[model samples]
Target: MPASRDQADRTQRVQLPDETGPVPVSIVHAEPRWFGVPPPLLLFGLAASLFVLALVLLAVGSWPSGLILLGLSALLTAAFLETARRRPGSERMRAAHSWTSSRLELAREHAKRLAEVQGLRGRRAVIESERRS
Candidate 1:
């Protein structure tokens, strides 16, 4: 028996039902199980709020304004300090000093799976867009 044309090509094809057109990109999504808000976002919000308060004081330039800014700044710092009492994530950061984790991992996995998923042969488009950027 003769080998078929597809067998001669040495490549496989798959089909995804919902795909509309070529995507030409890498997409990484978070793990589905965890939905809680990160603590760092809360800390950032507090700092941003304090910065706005300082801006208000800068507009007024009065002694009482200075006092109010100082009081609030102290309070924000103290709140951060209180959270630090748990000594959980901070200790890990201090020990390893590496910041990025799941975000990069997810990006790599998505790139691999996007190429492997049936009918999603958009790897060249993705690579080209990345090169342009």
Candidate 2:
């Protein structure tokens, strides 16, 4: 079955305690792609731009310098792709962690009475007890 909008909305919203003096809390969401470009495409673009620059340098200047730039570009492109490969997995993990935490917070809040009435030993009780510690 499809998930309910109410559960989705709870994850989208954040609650923070109000106090006279306390540090600010912020939630940041990472986008799946950088600047709307997928990592592979971005890597390609980086390499292409560098290759073009290296050609221009070779044409206008020296062969050694142009080759250096070309090599640097390749190295950079490889490094970027290596690092970016792990982003999607980390993003998925972060999102799952956030949703579960939100559900637990809601259980602690809305299920307090229900838990007490049900003799205080269920998922709700676990949530409430976790909140106290």
Q: Identify the leading candidate in terms of TM-score.
A: 2
* lDDT of candidates 1 onward, in order: 0.57, 0.67
- Report each candidate's C-alpha RMSD, comma-separated, in the order given: 29.3, 32.2
TM-score of each: 0.30, 0.31
Stretches of candidate 1 off by over 4 Å are: 1-41, 90-133
- Candidate 1 worst ten-residue window by lDDT: 93-102
Residue-wise lDDT of candidate 2 within 12-45, one digit each (tens)?
A: 5578778878768999997555464445545546
Model 2 alpha-carbon miss at residue 67, Å = 0.5
Clash pairs (backbone) in predicted model 2: none
Model 1: colliding residue pairs:
14-118, 14-119
Tens digits of per-residue lDDT for model 1 on 1-133?
A: 8766785757768876887789678899763332443354355356557757777777777657766775776565445444433333565533322222244368679988876874354766787899999
